[model samples]
Target: MASKGLATKRRQESGRRKGKEDGDKTRGGGGDEMKAGGGSSWAWKTKTENAKKVEALREIEQLEQKINNLDREKGVHLYNKRSDFRKLFCTLEEQELKLNSDRKTEKAKLRQQLNKMRGSVTKFQRELHNVKPTPEFVEKLKEIMETIESVVSEFKEQQKQIYEELLREEQTLNQEVTALEKRLESWASAPPITIETKSVKPKTVSSARNVIADLPPEVAAFERFLLQTGGHRGGWDEYDHGTFLRIRNKFKGKSAFLDEAATSIPGRNITDVRQHENWYQEYLTLMEKKKDGIQKWKIVKEAQKDECLTQAAVDEDEKKEEEEQKTRARARRLEEERREQADRLNAWKVQKELMKAKEEEKQIEIEMRRAKEYEKERLRQLEVRNQVQEYLQRKQEEDAIQRLEVESKKAVQEEEKKTMSREERVRFLERDQRRLEERLAKGKAKEEEQRKKSKRLERLKGQVEVQVERDPSRLYRLTEGWKERKKDTTSASNGPVLHMPHRAVPSWRAGL
Candidate 1:
């Protein structure tokens, strides 16, 4: 029994070790032995370093595969790569959102450029449509078109420079990343072997002061500035500042100045440009004031004490160079303003032409609509006159047809009378007269009888009314007599009727 229990315990231990090994393998351990460490455990180190490396390598492989799968046609890679969204489990949604954002930005840039050119073209077209062609107008339109082309070309050049700058930055970053990755791989492949020694070199602890000493004064100053201004809003980096300078140097004017600057710089918007502009203007003014103060101090120093001739000569040369630069800058600014004003005048002319064209079109439409309305009224009047004429003609035709029918009937009657002999005609007349006289006599007798009957009913009704007035109880008796008379009259006129005692009186005998 003791041996069996020991065997069972050993088996349980083996099973647990097997399970742990399986878990480790499943976790990408690849059955490698993990040595015990003094500080962080092997598992923790693997999770942090190895896991991160593996994830990065996988991402790189996926990117490479995507690149390989891209279309070989020129410029298709730019479009096709953005359409790919195979990173579903990790950053698919984020990549799609980024792609959409990039597409929208590109579209917006294209739309802005197109709108500028389109405005000029549409204005020219409107002017051409509304007003007669002239040499002066043609020349002006040509000039405007040329100006639009130049502006577009300048904008394109700025975009090209910005793209080149971005490419250089990306290449430099990639190079640094590759170098660091190579170093990490080399270290990982062959770790340094530590040997136990009795004597150890004294380790020097590097502090912030040592770090500051190692860096140049300019770098340290910049770092200090960065730290001091970290809490301030709308801070731009050196690259952004350089980009702003380039854009400012290229384009100048109040019209779309901020917009152009913002669009030219990737990731910088109008608000950032405005903030930078304010800060830069203040900085320039401050620097100018500072330089003036320095120059005044130098002059005072020279007057109060002896100064080197070489240094004085250098100072004069520097002051002359500064003045020249200021003059050049001023001249460039004035030129830009003149160009902008000309552009504004051209835009106003185009707008006025478009409005004039629209008004002419509206007036022409109104006139055409009035003409159509007049024509429609004339056609309606003609239709009404035709209908009236048709009605009169139809009435005449109907009257003629009726008259012909009466004449034909009369002819037939006359023909029949002519065919009859004289004596036969006389006998027929006597017979028709006798029949007519008999009908008249019967009608008179019936009318007289009806009148007498109505008179008798009236007498009866009056007697009943007089009795009812004299004795209120006599109403039922009179009503019963009236019912009997009604039954007799009904039997004489319409054979027989099954009379109900409660039946209402007929409307013709209601008075009785």
Candidate 2:
């Protein structure tokens, strides 16, 4: 018995080992060996290091896969992706926010440059309001834009003509170059044609604009001044010799190409070719105006020095820039007023049309509602008509049933009457009483049958329905139910039902 038990235990152990092997093979590779010290149970140090290395490598691979899947160019998480729900939603919302200060400044600088060229101070300043510029700053900006506009307006037509002239010159030069190349080829055996590469210089709309852009922002304000005044370095390069010499004498130590050009000249008169045009004169005037404005601004600051700009009231020196602001504001106000006036006229016209349309729509709606109501009433009337028809059908069925009962009872009585004289009938009834009783019973039962049928219909129609036993065998079992019922109903015999009681007649009528 002990040997058999041992044998059984051995078999169970062997089966468990086989099952474990199958399960291990089915599940996966033995990667957990790495987690268990890289399968190096013998050496502690190597086991730890190898396991750490494997884990690090796996983490790096996962991160690389993630990075590759993501689009880095957009620099934000993709909302459409499902990889990481919370992180992606937050990142997308952050990216959708408006620009900060650095971006604001960049955009402002770009707009200032564009508007300087475009020459629309009113539009530019309105746009600039978001920049939180001071009243003084805004006024200065308008002044500068005005000057730039004046310069461009003066030179725009001339510049167009200059562009045309340059185009013609370019065409002539090209023709000359072609002709010379042909001649040179022909004259290879002869004397070479001395055609220098006479490339026509193109006319440029070179702006003091770019100068402001190029200048280190340490002197950015001055550069801005130059831009505003349309005073290109090229223009200043064409200054008079005497002024050039004087500037050289004053700023002897400055080490800029512009400074050198302005200061030093050879035998030629730099300004003789192109003196200060209205633009240069305007530049000087602009400088003076800027100086005056700055001085006044300083004075205003001084007056408000003890009394703060914000913590105190307005002072007299700020009055001028303020007046300029009011004037510009008034101009914009008038322009806006004109626009509003036109808008009002348009609004009035639209309102009249809308009113007319609304009136028409109201009438149409009212008519539609009335029509729908009329149609609904007609439908209700139709439903009532159908209900009346159903009632009439039910009444007709009841009347037919009543008539059938009356006719059947009358026939039974008449059949009995034809049998014999009353004394003979009585004698004959005594003999055939059981058969007559059955006939009367059946006839009486039929009367009760209708009443029972009506009661069943009322019960069935009135109550919530419950399913009934509907097997054919069950139905067959009830096949003779009506006949059986009829047999039980009548106690009629040859004795006079001489005056059928009212209660019996009523029950008869009810059955029918």
Candidate 3:
């Protein structure tokens, strides 16, 4: 039984062992299958991660390709733009350089022009510097310039006269026009059969008289001379004087235009001139008196100082006298009046010198004006003479041309008359030739005479212009001076007319 049990146990154990093996194998295989499934899941996760990475890589590659395409397309355009900017910069730099160069050139030219003008001024000054004037020279120069000024003034007067004539003409024309217009209006307003008689404007009569009643004797005499000889102006007939008098009559009373023109210079009246001179003389006299007073005061003060200096004398009597004298002369106030007078004198002297310098300058200016006028006159005369000569030459040439033509015509006619045996000739040819020659000769002589007359007229006109421009009165020429101390032998020539020395009402300051 023990033996049988052992065999069964062995078999059971063997079977058990076989079953365990089979189970082990099955478990191992199942475990292996599970592990394999787990590995597959892990691999699937890895594959998902790898797939995402691959997709990301593909996107990166596409992006890279796009970028490359953009770079290729844009690179050329950017390079071309940079090249254009570089060229433009260089061109701008060149233009800026050219402008700077041009500016420098212009500045140099302007500098040169300025330098040339300065040089001309210097030269003119140098030339004038060497010509020192003599004492008489200044006087002569003044005379000449004054003459020139006079001539200029005369021309203006003539121009004024011409203008006045024009005004008269214009007035006449307006009157005629007004008359014509009125006639037309009357014709238009009247009945068709009725003749209209237009009324004439009344002739205006001026109640004013020539204000020459208060004229000085000299002025009166000059007026008489003017009336008697018709001004004796070259080429001006007696009729011209009548014309002048008519024009002059128009401005009998004070006119604003004439007054303003006359008073352009400050205090520009004859009376003012005399007053200024008197004032200056009085000022000089006062200064002299002040100087003399100062001198006297200085002497007195010196005497007082000497007395003070002697106050320290030793002798008893002298000391007593010195003390008494020192008491009278106080050192602090001793020379006060003298010092005051001295200062006043110095101030006065400075003013006097200034006034003197001003007077001298005025005189100098007058002289220069006259000199310039004289030169101008001389030049004018030369020009006039040249013009006359030129005219005469031209006239002679015309006459010669006419004469030659006449001679040629005559010779031709004479030659042609051979055919007719001198039986007939053209009428009026010889008479006409003679008349033309006479006309030419007369014209030449008249031209020369007119030239001379023009000069005299110009000179007279110059005098009138200056006198009138200064005062616009006949009295401005010193023609009515009544202050002259008359001598019995005073001639009735071109001199100032004096009135009886009664009393002159003092003149008032202007703009008072």
Candidate 4:
């Protein structure tokens, strides 16, 4: 029994080994088949799989048959559509040709009409060109223009004279107004005279008369002379005293001197010198006593005269200023009138120029139209010449191609005459195959080198990535270095460093 069990175990072990060997052989055979058929091998397919393939092939054949029927129908339909399209295309082509012919006829008729119109325009222009104004007519026109100018000048002169008269009246009225205003100002500025009872001094009219009557005749005459000469009495005291002494010396002992003085003096009547000697001597004594009063009176009179002279001078200056203002106004008006005349003349010249320009523009337009027509004809001729040249060039190119083709054919015939034998051709082909194999080997080597280079690049990229991972701020350091280099370069070129102001943080963002 033990022997039998051992035999059975050994047989089982052999069977297990055989089964493993068979599985390995089967796996190896599958691999070999896959390699030989590029993984599409069907030699080991099961019956069911073969059946499925046949069924699929049958379905494909049925689909192919249906597709062939659809293709035949589509072709028949397309043929019918093509026939209909060809008919339509032929009809359209016929219509197009008819339309083109009609258009050509109409274009020819319009061209002829345009030519006729152009000829008429040319004839009219020629006729007009020959007709010019006579010298007499031109002279008459000039005379008419001059007459019109003279009339306008006369009108302008009358207007200017009227304007001057008005200006003069205005100036006079202004002067009068100024004088009235000055008087008003003076009245307004004058102090009011108030009579107070405490300041009043009462005197009888007879006393005033007696004072006047008591004055020496010579003194009175000197006063009258001062009034007539517009002289103040400030310095008149010396004159009066001197005159009194002179009169006294001349008429003290002579009656004839008094008579002559009375007759020579204005509005004086002295009958006897001996009869008036006592009163005259009394008046001289009174005048001598009132010297202080006379001095005061002289000062008051001088002040009055000075005030009057100042007022007169002010009025004169005002008058002179007014005259100057009027003169300036007149000059401005004359200048304005002259400018208006000049503007009128300029306007007339501009009008004449505009008329001449319009005539010239018309002439230029005619010339331009003629030139355009000539240019159009020239362009048409150029187009015809260019077409001829292009046709000739195309013909020459075709001839050159034909010649090249003939040369190539002759070369091919000569090569055919010198053709190698089959063995030699086979040897040349083998040589070319060997050369191709060498080129393929070189290409494979180049590919290997490129792969090695790519692997090296990949290794370098991995090292750089590991380095960057080790130091995360390396990029920032690089950027800072680049910025420093740029700054150094800029500083070297610009010669100075510009310090920028530090940016201020907003109050809200200050903490951040």
Candidate 5:
């Protein structure tokens, strides 16, 4: 029994291990699809997975295409932005250039304006300087002003005369218009003829005034009462009446309706309310009678209205013809007046034009003469100015030459005095000392030679004296030769020789 149990246990353990291995194999092969009894499922899953993979790949491609499209759009957008920025920058640059040019132009204009103003100021100053403020000048100015004022006053007087004439013509036109308007009013005010229709009764009511006149005493009394009491000041107005009616209707079958109505009406007593109710009832009855009468009147009036309109039309046509004739006459008169005014204006214009032509000719001649004189003065001034400029230019050139010479001398002195280093200064001083020593030595040697020549001459003179004792002729020849030699030596010593001047060393250089 134990062996059977052990065998069963071992078999169970082996089966479990095998199952685990099978699971690992299946997982290693290809996941859940490789499990037992999964062939159809595996194929279906593979197909589905392939379809899903294809769909995923398609989605990824779509996404990639979208990304590429986005990138392309971004590139285009960036390019557009860059172009816009470039355009804007170019625009800004152009604006800046334009502004710079404008500013330069403005500066030039300002400079020109300043120059013009300066010239004007100078001219004015010169004029002021040349002017003499004399009584004669003042009197001339006053006379000129008076003459201008007189001319202006004369023009104003002529204008006043023209205005007076226009006012007279306007008054005449106004009077004629008033007469025409009065004639029209007279024609319009003529009484209209009454045409009685034989078909209807001639006694039918026509106007409200006739209706009132034909009303009974009771209706006249009612109308007078209504007029007296129906005002808003101390009466039951339409609003009060409406309120009273509304309250009365609301309280219709209840007690004390008049009191309620009076209360509801804002400002009315029971007595007034009762009277208003009575008047309203009587008004309703009167309105029915009035409506019947108005209907009868309307029928008669309508029949008469047609005939009256026909007569009125005929009368209007006649009036229109008369008005047309009047208007034509007025137009003819206006035309004639306008023609006369035009003739007068034409004559005035011609006269004014002739006067203006004369004035303008005189002014032009004066201006031309003044311009000629002014041009002569300007030429004279310009010539004088040119002469002055030439003289100033010549003086300036001479002064510049003198200044250049002075500046060159100063530059040389400054360089010599201030530009030397200690070593250079020592070198220059040593060189100068050497040249001075050389000059002194040459002078000393010349002095020694002159002294030696003097000694030799003395010796020769002594020898000549000794020889004179021996032979007078030989001594004389020797003395003559010595004299000639002395003359030659003196001449040679007096010959022109250049000497360098000694310079005094500055205190600073001496210290250095």
Candidate 6:
């Protein structure tokens, strides 16, 4: 019985070794080898544990294959999604480009319209500047000119009548002078007629008939002196003759003239008369009377001649002055007429210029108003364009921020996958998802805050624009304030901004 038991035990040990070898092969050797070197009971327990370990390793390998397949599928899906996102982004870019191009075209059309309006306004202004006066004012001026011409014609007719009358009078005077000259010539040429008559005793003519020839020598000499001293045609009057007679009477008793007479007479012998002092005195007195009378008559004649010449000169001067005055009056009237015509022409020109100026001013005012409206519209267009540009810039910034966040999350996921087991990796993914959610929430909150700030800024900008429109004087101040607020907001949030997945910033906020 002992021999039979030993053989059976050896057989059992061989079977156990064979099973250990199989288990080692299945468990990749180490655990099964340690169990094979141990006791029987421990070996049985190790075999079972090795079997379970082998099963678990097979299951793990199958699961790894599945995980690898899933990872490849996930990679393909992510690649396809990335491609779709790229295509979608390209499409959006194309659409945005098209929209921008359309906007540019619209802006150009608007500018063309504005330019055309400005050109029309300028043309209208030019036409206004060249405007003419109304026909009614021209007709009124023509009537005034016609009235002035009629008055001038009437004055010329009256002057011509006066000239004709003077010409007739001159002709009559010339004819009378000619007739008188002919009569005198005929009388001078008449033949002398001799008449025969009987001789008769002639009566002595009265001394007064030949008064000049019958006068005494001294008186004759005095009379000759008076005639020589007198003006042409015996200019001395009765008053002058009386003055000469009175002077002669005062010297009548003097005899100084007798001595002079004795020397002057050719055959006179007055020695005895010269010896008589009384007779000498009387003769001298008579001679002195004659001299005095001659001198007095000469003085009176000269004075009368001077008075007559003065009167004649005065009359001539007055006549000449009257003629000059008439000439001056005619010249003045002609000058006045010329001045009036010039004034009328200048007034017409001034009125025409004033009318043109008024028209130009009206046109200028219209042009200014149109220009102001155009400027306001242009400014509004510019503001819209600026808002669009700002919106585009902000969108670009948000897109860039989202791309950066996605890339960072992908890097973190790659790192977690590299370091963690599946379950740990899953926990890490969940944690990351949670963190991402929190970050997204925070980003959303920040975006909301930024949106609110932008909205506030927009409100402020609108208020500033309203103020600027209402009272342009405050434009500078409001603009400065807006700029300052914008700077403050920008400075306060100067850090990097993260974007959320769902929410989008408004275009107006981009403006802020």
5 or 6, which is superior by TM-score? 5
How would you encode candidate 6's per-residue C-alpha lDDT over 1-512 as one tens digit per residue? Answer: 12223233333343344455445555554554667677787667666877776786676568657756664543443334333344434444454456546546644653454445445444544544555698865565566556555654664575467457645544444433443443345345533222222343534443221343444455455444434333211333455334433433555736664455454444444563244334334445556876676566556656766656655554666556776998898677657755765797799999999999999999999999999999999999999999999999999999999999999988986786566556655767998999999999999999999999999999888777553346767755657667777665556467676864775553333432
Score residue 73 of candidate 5 by CA lDDT: 45
**Each model's lDDT:** 0.60, 0.53, 0.52, 0.56, 0.60, 0.56
- Top model by lDDT, which number? 5
Query: What is the Cα-based lDDT of residue 128 in candidate 5?
Result: 48
lDDT for each residue of candidate 5 in 1-512, tens digit (9 for 90 to 100):
12223233333343344445444444445644365655777777667766765675576568657756654544443334323344434443454456446545644653454445445434443554456689876675566556555654664576467457655544444433443453345335544445433355635323322333444444444444444444222244568877866776788725478888777776678888787777666666665665566566556666777768886765676667776998898677657755765797799999999999999999999999999999999999999999999999999999999999999988886787766566667888999999999999999999999999999999998887553345657744657667777664656667777876788776656853
Flag the better candidate by TM-score, 1 or 3.
1
Give lDDT tens digits, candidate 3, residues 260-361.
Answer: 323433434544433333443444454466456546645665676565544423344654566587766644333664476479779999999999999999
Clash counts per candidate, in order, are 0, 2, 18, 0, 0, 12
Q: Pick out the ten consecutive residues of candidate 3 with the lowest summed lDDT.
A: 206-215
- Please list the residue runs of candidate 6 whose C-alpha ends up more than 4 Å from where it truly belongs after superposition: 1-311, 314-321, 324-328, 331-335, 338-342, 345-349, 352-377, 383-390, 393-401, 404-408, 417-512
Candidate 3 global TM-score: 0.19
Q: List the residue pairs that clash in candidate 5.
A: none
Give the distance in Å from residue 28's predicted Cα in candidate 1 to where it truly belongs. Answer: 60
How far off is model 1, as Cα RMSD?
35.2
TM per prediction: 0.21, 0.19, 0.19, 0.16, 0.21, 0.19
- After superposition of all CA atoms, the RMSD between model 3 and the true structure is 70.8
RMSD per candidate (Å) reads 35.2, 39.7, 70.8, 58.2, 45.7, 64.8
